[model samples]
Target: MKQFAMLIYPGFTALDLIGPQTVFSTFRDAKIHLVWKTLDPVTTDAGITLLPTASFDTCPEELEILFVPGGVEGTIAVMKDGEVLDFLAARAEQASYVTSVCTGSLVLGAAGLLRGYRATTHWAFREMLPLLGAEPVDARYVEDRNRITGGGVTSGIDFGLRIDAKLQGEEAAQLA
Candidate 1:
């Protein structure tokens, strides 16, 4: 199975997680892990709650992909979360791919993962990329080496499909 670790934190935007997850769900051989600091219920900025299926301590040692979803306040907080940022920096070294959607890029940047990489995020926050030493691009998603960052929430679907194509094949992505 292709293992995926998806970060879920308090106040994560629902669509940011769901959009990419929907695409990943199409693959029968995929293992999607909703990961958090602990296996607890995480509330979204939209007021909805999601139960985490795994914790950072329990997550696979290596992953096919490490994904982070985004929310404004949450992203801001995560940018300052030393623990989460440290975990991401460590895991990203072993994972095949490192990714984020919307302001999640800022968190990745905070983790020191985006330095000198070309990336993109929610349009409103695109200007912030340079602060992290990331080259801001205006595309819906930017792929630099193994790091990928998607635009706003709705763009996650496209990002997921693209990743599916990269890991599988065009035929698989088309089917998804």
Candidate 2:
């Protein structure tokens, strides 16, 4: 099975994670991991709570996708979190695709995974990409090699569909 690890943290935007997750769930041979520092319930900015299925320590060493979702205050805090960054950096080395939605690209940047890559994020955070060593792009989503990043919250659906097309073909993505 293809393993997908999606990072979750307090205050994440629900749509940023769920939209893509809904798309990924359509894959027949993929296993999704809602990962966090611990296997605790993480609440979203919209007050939705999600339980993580894996902790940083328990996430698979090799993965088909390593994903991060965006937030407001929570994102800013995660960007400076050494443990989270370390986990992302380590897992990214072995992941087939490293991805994010909305401001989640900032978290990838914090992990030093976006340096020298073209990426996009929520419009408000686009300028901040340069500070993190990435070339900012204005688009619904930008894919640079193995890194795929989406714009604001709603753009996650488009991002997920695009990734689904890449992995499972256009017909599969269209059906989704």
Candidate 3:
């Protein structure tokens, strides 16, 4: 069974996390781990809070996939956070694929994963992608090899479905 780690931070977008959560959790064979900075409930951008399944230090060593969700805080946090950036950069090397939703691309870019890669993010942050050395693709969802990125909050689902097809196969993804 494939194990996926969904990384969420305070002030993250609810749709960015829940959209993929709903889609991926339907697969009984796959284990989805919610990773956060702390175990305490963290509020989403929409005012909803979720209790994380694991903290950063407690996350499983081997993750087949990693999903990073974006929010207002992510725009600032992921940019200047060396701890988060190092954590992502290290794990991204071993994970089968690394992905982001909305401004989550900013996080990925800050981690140095988007260097020389064309990616997309929330329309609001589209112009800022160059700061991380990434080219903005301006698509709702952009897939470049092992990296998949989505635009804004709602686009996370489409990004998840695209990844589902790539990782699990068309039939499996369609079922999702």
Candidate 4:
């Protein structure tokens, strides 16, 4: 079975996490690990709560994919969270694919993973990517080889489907 890591942050959008989670979890052969800066329970901007399976430093290192879901608090995270950025930076070195949704793309930018890559984020944050040296793409989902980005919250489902196809195959993705 392949493993995927989902990074959770305070004020994250619920659909950004839940949509991809549902699509990935539908496959019995896949393992999804929800990770956070710490192991404590985290709350979403919409008030959904999740108990992280592990902390950033304790997550499995051999993940097949890493998914960063956007939050309402993207700017603050980009500017303030060293642990989140460090973890993302380190993980990007080994993860087969790095992906994000909505302002989650900002987190990737913060980690320096999206530099020079064409990516997309929430419509509201589209203009901010240039500040990080990323080419902003306007799309529900954009797959730039190893990096996959999606726009807005619900776009996570589309991101998941695209990744599923890449990692598994169109038939397996359809089954998922």
Candidate 5:
């Protein structure tokens, strides 16, 4: 089974998390883990509450995909969080794909995962990418090496389908 880990924190955008997750769900025998620092419920920017399936310490050591979702206040806070960054960095080392949606790229950049990588994020935050050692691109999504980043919120579906095609196949992505 393919293991996918998605990071969740208070104030994350619901669409950012749900879009990709919906696509990932179509994968056969895949395990999607909603991970956080603890097994507590996280509230999204849209006022939706999501339950975490795994804590950072309990997440799989190896992952097929390591994903992060983005929001305004939450993204900023996560960028400055050492523990979350450390966990992301460690898991990313073994993940087949390291991905983000919207401002989630900023969080990955904070973990130093986007350095020297060509990436994309929400348009409003594009200028800030250079500061994180990433070359910002204006597109729905950008893929550099094993790193794939989606643009603004709704772009996550496109990003997820792109990844699905890469991991599965064009036919599978279309089916998804």
Candidate 6:
């Protein structure tokens, strides 16, 4: 089975997380894991709550993908969290793909995972990527090596489809 681990934190933008998740769900052999530091409810920026299905401590040792979704304030704070960054970095080292939507790319950068990668994010924060050592690009989505990031929230679907094709094949992405 293919396993995917998605990080969840308070104030994460709903669309950034949900759009890609919807696409991933269609794969019958894929196991989607909503992971947080704890197995508790995380409040999104939209005020909706999402219950985490797995905890960081219990995440699968191996994963096909490691995803992070962004929120403006949350992303800023997450960038400074050592434990979270450490977890993400370690996971990225092992996963086949390390991805983010919107400003989630900043979080990946904070983990020291995107040192020389070309990436994209919410337009307003594109300039800020330089602070984290990522080359900022203006695009709906970007793919550099195994690190992919989407621009803004709605672009999650586009990023997801790209990831689907990488995970499965062109035909699988077409079906989605």
Give each model's whole-structure lDDT.
0.92, 0.97, 0.85, 0.85, 0.97, 0.92
Candidate 2 has a TM-score of 0.99
lDDT of 4 at 167: 69
Model 3 has an lDDT value of: 0.85
Candidate 1, residues 82-134: lDDT per residue as tens digits?
A: 88998899889899999999898989999999999999999999999999989
Relative to the unseen true structure, what is the C-alpha lDDT of residue 170 in candidate 6, on a scale of 0 to 100? 90
Q: How displaced is residue 10 in candidate 2, in Å?
A: 0.6
Query: What lDDT does candidate 1 reach at residue 11?
Result: 87
User: TM-score per candidate, in order?
Assistant: 0.98, 0.99, 0.93, 0.94, 0.99, 0.97
Q: For residues 56-173, could you state the per-residue lDDT of candidate 2 as single tens digits?
A: 9999999999999999999999999999999999999999999999999999999999999999999988999999999999999999999999999999999999999999999999
Q: Give a tens-digit lDDT track for model 3, residues 49-115.
A: 8898988898877778888999886558656888888888878988888898988889999899998
Encode model 5's per-residue lDDT on 62-105: one tens digit a residue: 99999999999999999999999999999999999999999999
After TM-score superposition, the amount by which residue 154's alpha carbon in candidate 6 deviates from its true location, in angstroms, is 0.7
**What local lDDT score does residue 14 receive in model 2, on the 0 to 100 scale?**
92
Cα lDDT of model 6 by residue, 1-176, tens digit: 99999999988899999999999998879999999999878999999999999998899868899999999888878899998998898888789989999999999999998899999999988998998999999999999998999999999999999998988899999999
Ten contiguous residues with the weakest lDDT in model 6: 72-81
lDDT of 4 at 137: 91
Spell out the clash pairs found in candidate 2: none
> Can you tell me which runs of candidate 5 are displaced by over 4 Å?
none
2 versus 4: better lDDT goes to:
2
Backbone collision tally, model 3: 0
